[model samples]
Target: MPWYAPRHLEEALALLAERPGLIPIAGGTDVMVDGNAGAAGREYLSLAGVANLRGVSETPLGLAIGALTTMTEIGRHPLVCRHLPALAASARVTGAVAIQNRATLGGNIMNASPAADNPPVLLAYGASVVLMSAMGSRHVPYAQFHSGYKETIRRPTEILGEVIVPFPPDHAHHYFRKVGTRRAQAISKVGLAAVLAGRPGSWECVRFGLASVAATPILACALAAAITGSDHSVPRDEELAEALGRDIAARDDIRSTADYRRRVAINLVREALAPWRSQGGFDASH
Candidate 1:
């Protein structure tokens, strides 16, 4: 019922340390939705005024995307677009323009929704999260951040400080697709985000991340191995299907059926890999 608005990051961290149950609100996009539904009864710690947590910066490791950076900023920022185009694409497709203006990278991850658009992209790019507390900060690999559905490794005492996206190889292939009821503002029925290095065959590195098909946005390690090990040839559909079976854990949900999601996920992978199968290699011009 009470609201705590802090103008500084240190002040916010102190408040969180003193009141472990304080719910942090940045964009308030999700929190307001919960409040409107009579579900958000707890006091809110507003981080809107914490200006330090709201921009993008370069770091020795890669790009340091401040936690409070709005989806719209991410989508339009030249740095993000050049280095992590899939992330930029995911941000552009997250919600309508208004929602994108308010929704933030930190809030999205902290919400820990299995169908969230950005997590799969983060996973695919081998990103890391910087979680800060009054004590200090720690980095958690994005792939290991989500432990289960609607849950994350972020501690109650810690605030997500920033997301660190490592630079991919210059010739890397990036792909992202989200299937939902409609294009913008709809929750994803299934989504895939991937970063591939080297050619289709003789692949040097591969990371495929899928959403709405597992307890968490998952790295399809088994599927990646199957494709990467295919001896410079296109993998058969059966092989792809079997690897997908080992990777995803889709189930019947209101938006789609387990069978439908499975089939669609495989098809999406095939479509993304079509460049590999036909072009001899990724064509950057397209």
Candidate 2:
């Protein structure tokens, strides 16, 4: 595919609308792989010169992270680290350092990979994507953005603008763990993001989202809701694992068996909530 760098998003959007075979390329980390394999005779809109689609800031709603914000920046941002620690942790482990330097949060989300680390974290944080077109702009929750494996609801003419994540409550804690073939530079076999709040005797919020264990990354809403109001602190790991095994719709893939992913998802849930067993509340440091 031939490449053209658009100076502005409007130009890119216009090109996308006019050119039936145009592909948008930001980091090109994921796109190029397909393009290199003879998915050609098309044009690519490079967003490197689009200045507006970059940066991270605190917004009235929460944090507004620009579509082009790199994983490296996301991992190191003090604001991100302090508030959305799971996201920060996810970004840090998202690839090797070099890929992190080039990978954008928007690209990561737009890729819509089942194993993509950002989605689990962002979904757990209740994040939304700001999508803009020549017509107008709209916000879509991360959970709803992905419709299927490697597929998103984004139209070709619409550009992903930014990500909005509401700040979790001060009492909230987060955990992100990925099971892969290697420690780094390997795709996730099973990834989990868990967030919890409140003290031992009372439970306020309990959310768990897992990647590479379903058709699309999922927030175990039904199960989370089931345990949200309970006073029980030491999680019933076995029962929870059984529930996960029964509830999660997983399939055997090259990474692992569906049964294995199901097992890991349950264990991740248990481990993430294990901190509550101690004297204080959950801890993110672990």
How high is the lDDT of residue 56 in model 1?
92
- For candidate 1, the TM-score is 0.95
TM-score of 2: 0.92
Q: Which stretches of candidate 1 lie over 4 Å from their true place?
A: 35-41, 200-202, 282-286
TM-score of each: 0.95, 0.92
lDDT of candidate 2 over 40-152, digit per residue (tens): 47677788689789988999999999999999999999999999999999999988998999999989988888889988988888889999877789999887998988889
Backbone clashes, candidate 1 = 0
Number of residue pairs clashing in candidate 2, backbone atoms closer than 3 angstroms, sequence gap of 3 or more or interchain? 0
Global Cα lDDT for candidate 2: 0.82
Give me the candidate number with maximum lDDT.
Answer: 1
**Which 10 successive residues of model 1 have the least lDDT summed?**
34-43
Error (Å) of candidate 2 at residue 71 is 0.7
